[model samples]
Target: MADTTQDYTPGSHPDLPPPSSEVGVIGWLRHNLFATPLDWALTILAVYLIYVLVVPALDWMLFSADWAGETRDDCSREGACWVFARVWSKVFIYGRYPVEELWRVNLTFIIQFVGLAALMIPGVPYKKWTGIFLLIPYPIIAFFLLYGGAFGLEPVETSLWGGLMVTLVIAEVGIVASLPIGIVLALGRRSKMPIIRAICVAFIELWRGVPLITVLFMASVMFPLFMPEGVNFDKLLRALIGVAMFSAAYMAEVVRGGLQAIPKGQYEAAQALGLSYPKVMTFIVLPQALKLVIPGIVNTFIGLFKDTTLVLIIGLFDLLGVVQLAATNPDWLGFAVEGYVVAAVGFWIFCFAMSRYSMYMERKLETGHKR
Candidate 1:
């Protein structure tokens, strides 16, 4: 044993730092951006493109942009006239909702903000109750607050509801209303009953086949012709219904895809345990299916949010629509670009938030199942 036998053991030696060219920012750049000739070329090309396009855009948007001003006359034509956005900010948010009763709108926004914060933020207690409050009573409260014919409040017409307020209302209603409808459709599509399946398939296809704009148009126009003579639907109501139905069709397909991904063994196992169809679906299948389809569901929601802008065609001004309308004002003329930029930024923020939330949910769910 004492003979010249050298000890050789992995990890016995003190760990030395990795090479400078293989571990830090330079290493990352080398591995990811310059790993090969093609990567190097692409990295250089991307940088050049960004410099050519984004740098000047940033300069125009930030450094050169006019921020402090009261009117279009105060703006210099060399850069963006953000004063247009500033002057019309209230109009962009509250639209034609009377200035004297703006408190109701402000209150509704406050309540919603609190409710959403409770629901989304971690460690909030009694979340189920909070969710129920948001899902059921909050909508009624919001409607009354915004519409305000009840509770001795002044009545604001649906026509007065435009801008970000209307946009959010339509989007929230569509999102909340569509999910359950979509789930039912998806289940019906997969049902063993031929009649149910046929009806679901027909409904989904009918909505999905047509463009959303056409659906909105029909809801605003042709839909009322079939109704009773004295009964008239609010244009915003029609648009909301149309948007919900249209989104539900797409949502049904997404949910159905998730349903199909579940292994047959799981269903058989649930049945073996003496679970009924509804029980199995509620307790096991739907939970898994919905989790699997979070990305698709959120994608649908983002699209639906953006599609609220299309309601402008039906004469319901959403956020973008309001901005466009404000831009046309005689005093604010020639600032259409600034208004559009504001709307674009607003949309991007919402869409990006949704996307990030989707990613967070995915990571939280730890959906590691193999497809």
Candidate 2:
């Protein structure tokens, strides 16, 4: 007897045509840019805007640009004067950080890169513990490296630290220090105890309600009054405290949102399993909550990074501060556009890369919630 069952092939569909050549670039454009009248209109508008902005930029940055030679005087062209940039590149990157001690900053960058790379790798066992260790000791190591008061190295004051180096230090320290403090605040805000919740709420609200500049001012000027008569805090330390406190307030709100998003079922289930509140939070709820809000956390970090530039307002030299300083230099005068453009590009690249990484992490950690 012959079998009458229909046959199934694992491969291609016989009824469908082979993939079309137009389905790549042309198809993508058609679908995304010309799918409907509205899309087409938007695409045209975007193209026009791009042309309006980019054409002139290209002309200034490349076509009529002066890339070679020394001094602004050499470039008599109508394009961007990058000669000024070339002359003051070190000042923009390192500020007044001594030329001889530049190696220390470079070494700090190397260590930070290595540590971050290690933390990012998923295959590393005990990753959480490793991250904790990196987080805890990094400030101390970075401080010693940058300040250089120990190990027979000459003492470098915070006032001398400027440029991107200061920006990175402030941002990194703020984010790291704020995280745990934020976590505690978030927990307190949701705590059963009225006093704890009230205190947390007040702290978060007070900090968030005020502008960061005012906080920085307080840190720089008012903090000295609060200190003991003979002792004085470093300007950088004061700025760090201001940034950390401001960041913690915002971070607390972000973490609280994460906590609210977590299902009550998870909390009850953890309790049902005879686990303590801390254990439940650490082992079950917080992991899920944090994963859910990773993007928000990264956004906060990006904001903090950008805000670190504001230290210039309180007389602390950061990346933007250094750029402003270079722009006003008598030797390289009348090059504000070049200096600002460089700083803006640097900031854009850093923030853009961080935003992209956050998106990647979100996708990498996404798990289907289908029941």
Candidate 3:
């Protein structure tokens, strides 16, 4: 040892850290953005395109935008006239709901928010009971709170219901009403009985084949003719029913695909445990299948939510419709862009939230299904 052998321990050379370029932000960029020549080129091109296109757009929308104004006269032609949106904010949110009675609409929204938060957040007590209340009775309470034909509350016609309020009402009702119907249809489509399967197939296809606009048109127009004499169906109610049925058709297909993806062994295993058909599906099959198809189901819901805009065709002014209505006003003649931007952002927020929730569910329910 005193002779020229270096003192060293086997497998120990002061374990070196990875190069800094292979570690943090630099590593991520190298691995993802500049992994190959093609990626490098694409990244550079994307940066260039964003600078060329998005930079000016952002400049117009933010830096030069007129945020402080009470009327269209305050807008300078050089940038976005956000004043139009602000002026018509009432119509955009609560629609023609009486200014004096805006409290009802606001209260309904508060209740909905509270109910949803209590249900969704973890560690809240009595979720099962809360869900039962929300499912069975909350709709009735919300309806009366908005419609107001009882409890000494002044009645607001469905005709007065427009803008984001109506938009959310339609979408929420359609989503809630459609899910169970779709599940039943999905089950029926896969049923052993021939007649039941055929019926489910026919119903799903019939609704799926028709465009949503046509469905809304028929619901608001032709449906009245078929009703009995002296029987008046609320226009909003008709639209709700049409939307739910149409969405249910697409949802059934989604659910069916999920059900099919399930391994046959799972079903056979449940059966072997002496479970009945309904019991097996309720306990095991549906839970797994729904978890797998969360994305698809949420996609359908997003589509339905956007399609709620089409109710404007039936003379119901949704968020978009209200904006369009405001744009036509002589006082706000040339600010359609601002109004449209508001509506677009509103829709994107709701749709994005739903999409994120779907992803969360997917992650929460993740099993050994991924590669």
Question: Which segments of model 1 are wrong by more than 4 Å?
Answer: 1-43, 367-371
Candidate 1 or 2, higher TM-score?
1
The digit string of per-residue lDDT tens for model 2 on 176-243 reads 88999999999999999999899999999999999999999999999999999988998999999999
Q: Is candidate 2 or candidate 3 better by lDDT?
A: 3
Q: Each model's RMSD to truth, in Å?
A: 4.4, 6.0, 3.4
TM-scores, one per candidate = 0.91, 0.88, 0.90
Give residue 116's error in model 3 in angstroms.
1.0
Error of 1 at 103 (Å): 1.8
What tens-digit string does per-residue lDDT give for candidate 3 at 198-317? 999999999999999999999988888989998899999999999999999999999999999999999999999999999999998999999889999999999999999999998898
Q: For candidate 2, list the clashing residue pairs, or say none.
A: none
Query: How would you order the candidates by TM-score, starting with the best?
Result: 1, 3, 2
Q: Per-model C-alpha lDDT, please?
A: 0.92, 0.88, 0.92
Which lDDT value does model 2 have at 49?
93
